[model samples]
Target: MMHAVVVFETLWGNTEQLAREVAAGLGLESTDVVDAVSAPAMLEDDVDLLVVGGPTHAFSMSTDKTREAAQQQGAENIPRRGIREWIASLASPGRDIRVATFDTRVTSPRLPGSAAKKAMKRLVALGFRPAAKPHTFGVHGYSGPVADGELERARRWGEELAATR
Candidate 1:
């Protein structure tokens, strides 16, 4: 049985729901879907796989301070504020970890896949392989009902990831 940890940050709860579905798909008798902010300290060490996500803020993952700075700068493209900065702060340093990522955002149909690209780059730099494209669950402005197919897609993504290892 594979041990997996799925953690996420959400302002409007859409992303958290997605994380839970990911855990369900893994079908682990022991699994955790936790809020990134209050996550336990040793959450990362023993998992066979790590899934992390948040809403896209400023074309990347959300950081509490960056959202404030963007709000002050009048930037319209910031993602909601959360623990993405904490993710960047982690010092994996040559560790071997398999990771996948996802995000929740309104479908731009115009940004042309920019956020996923940025997320893949960040994940690789943090010593994780880009296992899958970063997914974006939809929202009507900010609070979301999640687009029609988004949850199903997420569930399918989880199954696929589980099958990979």
Candidate 2:
């Protein structure tokens, strides 16, 4: 079985729930789901895959300013640091480690950018290999219960990611 770690940042819990579902699909016995703020700066030697995700904000990944704005909009448990900051802190793994990324965005008024795409590029720059293309999961609104069926899609995506390894 492949060992995987899923790191994520969530403003209103939609992304976090998706992260958990992804981990479950990857096989809970061998996967760990962690909030970005608490995620490790470097992967363990035995880890085969790293999955990262967060909510899309202002067309891409969340920043401190955006997180603060979310808090003002009644979002609770906003992370002190978001995916961008956490990714900035990552240490190069020094060997090939597969990675996949995902993001949650509003379902309406199709967005122009993706946090997942941006994150995938950064991780690749840091020496992690892409296991698959970046993916986006939809939510009903800014603060949403995720769009119907997205959770299952995320799970299937996770399974597909595992198969790629």
lDDT of the candidates, in the order given:
0.68, 0.92
Instruction: Give the range where candidate 2 is weakest over 10 consecutive residues by summed lDDT.
Output: 21-30
On lDDT, the candidate that comes out on top is 2
**Candidate 2 positional error at 130, Å:** 0.3
At residue 111, give the lDDT of candidate 2: 81
Q: Once model 2 is optimally superposed onto the true structure by TM-score, how far is the C-alpha of residue 105 displaced, in angstroms? A: 0.3
Estimate, for each residue in 75-140, the C-alpha lDDT of model 1 and write its tens digit: 454443355554655555366667788887776543434344565577688777656666666755
Task: Write model 2 residue lDDT over 55-108, tens digit each, in one string.
Answer: 999999998888899899999888988899999999998998999999999999
* lDDT score, candidate 1: 0.68
lDDT of 2 at 85: 95
Report each candidate's C-alpha RMSD, comma-separated, in the order given.
4.2, 0.9
Which run of 10 residues does model 1 get worst, by summed lDDT? 108-117
lDDT of 1 at 135: 69
TM-score of each prediction: 0.78, 0.97
